[model samples]
Target: MFGSDDFKDQAVWEFSFRIDDGGFSWDYKFKPPLWKSVVGRTLSKNNDVLLLDASHDEPTDGREETSAVFQSRFLEGIGPIKGVIYGYHQGPEVLKATGNQTQLKNWLRDQTGVRVYRDNVRVFNYGEPSDDWLGLNVRRINRPGDRFGTNSLVAAISLDLESSYLLKEKTNREGFDGGGAFPRFVKLVLSAFERFEHVAIDDRKALDDVIRGKGTAVAPVRFLDAMDSLKAGVKSKNIPKAFQREIDAIEREYTELRDVMVSAGTAGLNLAVIFHEIEREVDALAAAVERKLDEQSIKKQIEQIHYMLHGFAPLLRKNPAKSIFCSEVIEQATRVRKSRFAFHSVVFSAPVLTKEEPDFKIKAAPNLLVGAIGNLLDNAMYWTKVRQELDASNGSRAIRVFDSAQGR
Candidate 1:
C-alpha cells in the first residue's frame, strides 16, 4: 500500500537538464515528464519504479526506462506535414443558441475537460502551449479585454488535427463564419454532418426513382454524390462526426448509410470524449505544475498518443513509472527537538498536509470581521478548485497552504 508517506520520497523525481542552457528552466523540474502533475494524482504512485532509477539515470536512457518510443521513430514517414498534422484536429472536434443553451453551456463546461474553455459557443484548450507543430496553428489570445474590453483573460491553444474546411470567419449565426482555426474546424465538421443529413433525403429520392422502375425517385446520381461527400468527410481524418445532427437525420432516412455513418458518429463521440479527458488531464497537469514539463515532450507525448499506440514506449521512456493511473496519498514527515537544559522541548515539525486541509488562520478583529470572512471565503474558493495532495508522487495542486494557531 503506497500511502502519502510513500510519495514524498525524493525518488519521485528524476535528475537531468541541459547544462548548456544555464541553471534550470521549466523542463528541469520534471526529470520524468509523467512525474509532473498530470500523472501525479492519476498516476504518481510508485509501482515498482518500472522505468529508470531516480538516483542514476540519464535523459537518453535505455529501453527499460522508456514507454513511448515509436512515437518519434514510427512517425518518421507519416506524412505531408500539413496532411498528417491536420488529420487529428477535427477527427478530434461545440455549441449553442440561447435560452437553456446558456444553462447547458455552463453544465457543459463543468462536464467537459476543465481544459476546455467555453462561453455559450466555443470551447478552448489553450494552455501549456505545446512545442511541436503537428499541423496545429496555435494562437495566443492575450487578454481580450485590453484589446477589446477590461474583462479579459489570456490563453493559448494548439491545433494539430487535420481538416478540410475551417471556421475561420463568422457566418449567419446558424452555420459558421470560419475565421480562427477552431471555428473553421467546427464549421466544416457541422457541414459534414449536414451532408450526412441530405444523403438520406437524396437516397429516398433515388430509391423512389429506382423502385418506380423509372426516373421517379430523386436520382441515384444525387444519392451517390451524397455518399461521396460523406466518405470525403471521413477521409479527411479530422475528428469525424463533429456534425452530429445531420447524421442523425440520415439514420432516420437510410439504414445503410446510417450504419456506416453512425459508427463514424460514435467514433467522433469517442474522440470528443477522449479529447475531453485529455483536456482535463492536461488542464489539471498544466495548472498543477506550470514549469515542470518539457513543452516539447508534452507535444510529443500527445502526438504519440494521437498517432501510434506503439509510440507509448518512447513516450514512457522518461516516465514509464508515472504513466499508469491516478491515486491519492496523505503523507507527513515530522521532527522533535529537546534542549540540553531540558526545561522544555520544542517540536519543530513540517507536517506535509495530506487529506487536504485549510492552512490559513482566522482571527476576530474589531469592525473587520468582514475582511476575515473575505479571506476565509477567498481561501475556500481556491481550495475548492484545487486538488491538493502533497506527495511529489501525487501531482500536488498547490505547494502548501498555511492554516491557524495551534492549541497547545
Candidate 2:
C-alpha cells in the first residue's frame, strides 16, 4: 500500500500509519483502501495525511461498541492508528536563502485553511477562500489575537467511518449530513485549534522580540548601561569635571528651548484658526455685495446694509475694551464700496460728527467691523444701480452714513 505510485508522487510533510490486523496476517500486503487511493490522487505536494486502521471486528459477545465510545477511543491514545503528529516551519536559514519572505508568506496565505475528506472524497465549500466554514474569520474579526488567520494555515482531517456507520455525507457534498457524528467532528477540530492558538501566540511574541532587538547587547537597556559604565570610568580616571558640568548645563538649556518651541507651535495653531474665520466672513460679505437688486428699492436696501454691518460688530470685538472712533470704523467699513460706487457713478457720503454730539468711540474688532459695514454698502450700491437703470431720473445712486453715541 505504501509503494503505490500515487503515494510516491505526492509530498507528505507529515503522516500517521496504523493497522489493527487482529493478528490475521503480518505478511499480507493488502491494497490501499478506497479513501487512501482517492487521497493519494487528490492530495497536494504540500499536504498532510492521517491514516487509520479501525478494521477490528465487532465483539462476539453481542455488545457492540457505541459510536460515541468509538469516537472517544479514536481521540484517546489506545487506537491502532495512534502516532505522534508533527508540523514543520521553515527555519531562519531557509528563509534567508529564499531572500523573499514576502513571496513565501503570500504563497502560504494562498494555501491556508482547512479541507475535510470523508471516505477519500474531498468535502465541498469547507476550504474555499471565501468560505469561513469554521467561523475562524468571524472570531478573528470580533476578537482579534495574534493567532492564525485563514491565509496562514493549511490543514486536512481525513475520517474513515465505514465500520462505525454513524456518519453520512450530504447529497449536495457540502459536508457531512446533520447526524450525530457531525457535531462531534466539528468539536474535535475546534478543540485542537484552541491548543494550536496558545502555541502560536508564544511563537509570535518570540519573533517580535527578536525583530525589536530586545534582550540583546544592542537593546535599549544594554545601551543605557554601557553609557553609564563609560561615565563611571571617566570619573575614576579624574577626567575634567568641567566638561561634565558643561554637558549638564547644555542639556538644561535644550529642555527649556524645547518648551518654548512647543508654546510657539500652539500659538501658531490658534492664529491659523483666527485667520480662517476672518477669511470666511470676508467671502460672505463679498458675495452679498455682488448680488443684483430691483430698481425701486433704494432706501430699504440701505437699511438692510446698515443692519448687516451692525450684526458684524460683536464678531469684530469679542471683548468690550477695544475701542475705535465711530467715524473711523464706518470709513474703514465703507472702503470696500469705493470701487463699486465709482463704476455705478454713485456718490458715497460719511457725515462729519458735530461738536455738540461728540463722535464717540465704540468697542469692536477692526476687521469684522469694517467687513460688516462694507457688505451693507455693497448691497446698497447694487440696488441703486438697478434703480438708475430702471429710471433715468435716478441716474446716480447715493449712500449716506450717520453714527450716533447710542450705537446705531
The C-alpha RMSD of each candidate to the native structure, in angstroms, is: 29.3, 30.3
* Over 4 Å off, model 2: 1-97, 100-106, 141-146, 161-164, 216-408
In model 2, the clashing pairs are: 305-376, 316-365, 317-365
Q: How close is candidate 2 to the true structure, as a TM-score?
A: 0.32
Candidate 2 lDDT = 0.46
Best by TM-score: 2
lDDT of 2 by residue, 1-408 (tens): 223333222211233322232311111111122221112111111112221111121121222231112223343221222111122233443334344545554555565567766556667767778765666665564234454556545666555555434456678877667655454445445444543454345444444455445553453555446556767876889989887786566656865675455444333323333343344445545555566434335445455456544534433433323688877777655543443355446787776433334577778545545545655665565556445534546345797777544377
- Candidate 1 TM-score to native: 0.15
Q: Model 1, residue 349: displacement in angstroms? A: 23
